[model samples]
Target: MTTAPAGPDPTMQAIGQAIAEGRAGDTTSARQKLLSLWSVIGATGDPLHRCSLAHWLADLYDDPAQALAWDVRALDAADAVTDQRVQEHHAGLHIAGFYPSLHLNLADNYRRLGSFEAATEHINAARTHAPSLPQDSYGDLLRGAIQEVAEAIALRDRSRRASAPGSTA
Candidate 1:
């Protein structure tokens, strides 16, 4: 039920700076800044803000389990976004366009956690939605990343089965 601010929030600018810091290898500073912003944004803030914050926060965690929790929060927040809100927050971007990347992140997190079943489920979801993404360089990059993750999961599953007890290979 939370509504987005009428205009861009200054805090979002700080969050962007934090993201830049993270990209520049200052993850510790980035995380600290993001944590501070999260405190201001609160748990019940605008869905777009929550989704973006949670998605970025997930990358700051080294543990896949913790990252998965943040990814889940991001997805849940994304689900709450209305079309009107999407127009307000992201202009041309639709909520549906976010799903493929979210699923890919979830799949990667699940794979790192050794939950192959969950990983495959999200990987399939990512593939299902990949075509709906904008046909641009970013979309192409995401598609390639999705394929790479899928291959990694397949390789991991194969190794897992080969090492399992009573394997007939």
Candidate 2:
């Protein structure tokens, strides 16, 4: 007989619910809830919470600069996260697998802000971490998006990609 792993984290579940609200087009509620959570978490909170919150918060902003701010915060927090911490919420998850998407988002935001040099650096970082991504739909999506952002950076295009998150109002 084996013991079951711990149940869902209520805080993470709340974050997921807010993220779902955003996905459902009720972004105001999502942003507000996340903001409320942020107040509780403070700046030096759990690395996972900081990383997750900042990443999702970045997606709520239409302005590239604003989005870039949140993305930077996410990346900063990501640096402090441990694989063990990630496994607490997701048994199969590893911190390494998170880098590709995190870097890709930063690259996209920098690209949109006309910071090609910064964007190129982050895109390269994303590609460097790409191998860590699982060979699944999520991996495919990030890989494809990385290519798209890289091409835009090469062309010096400042317009947002239609498929990019935070493109809508």
Candidate 3:
């Protein structure tokens, strides 16, 4: 006899259904519902629930850093259950989503803070994670542009540092 996979908590199941529908174009109340369910999934240490929640949050929210943070937690829970699916999801988010997002956010924040060197570093980091595309795809071109911007900022910072009022150049 085949046994059914144990289902998640009723509340979590409800949140999961909502998140799925939200992804299909229903966000009016989806965000609030997911937020409310986050703590519950987190507390239960349920990898499936946590992974589902993280993916939903990432899509509904534009904050990569926050999404990455959630993904990290989800990964931890997944690890506890020895779940390969959860590991794959976590890796995909990092390799395809969070890394680039964090790179962009870091670059923007550094530029705004007048930390040109820091900005350049983030840009390079982002490039490292960027996906390869057609021989000359738009994403490749964009990544190249970001790299150039970072390099220019790094050079400016270096020049400023060298010219600063200090005993050593």
Q: Tens digits of per-residue lDDT for model 2 on 39-81?
A: 9988899989989999998998889998899899899999999
Model 3, 66-85: lDDT tens per residue?
A: 54455455444434444444
| lDDT, candidate 1, 1-169, per-residue tens | 1354456767667778888888777778888888888898888898888888888888877777877898998899989988788777646667888899889889888987888899999999999999878888878878887888898898874222221111121
Off by over 4 Å in 2: 1-6
CA lDDT, candidate 1, residue 17 = 88
Steric clashes per prediction? 0, 0, 0
Regions more than 4 Å wrong, model 1: 1-7, 157-169
| Candidate that would win on lDDT | 2
- TM-score-superior candidate, 1 or 2: 2
Residue 4 CA error for candidate 2 (Å)?
10
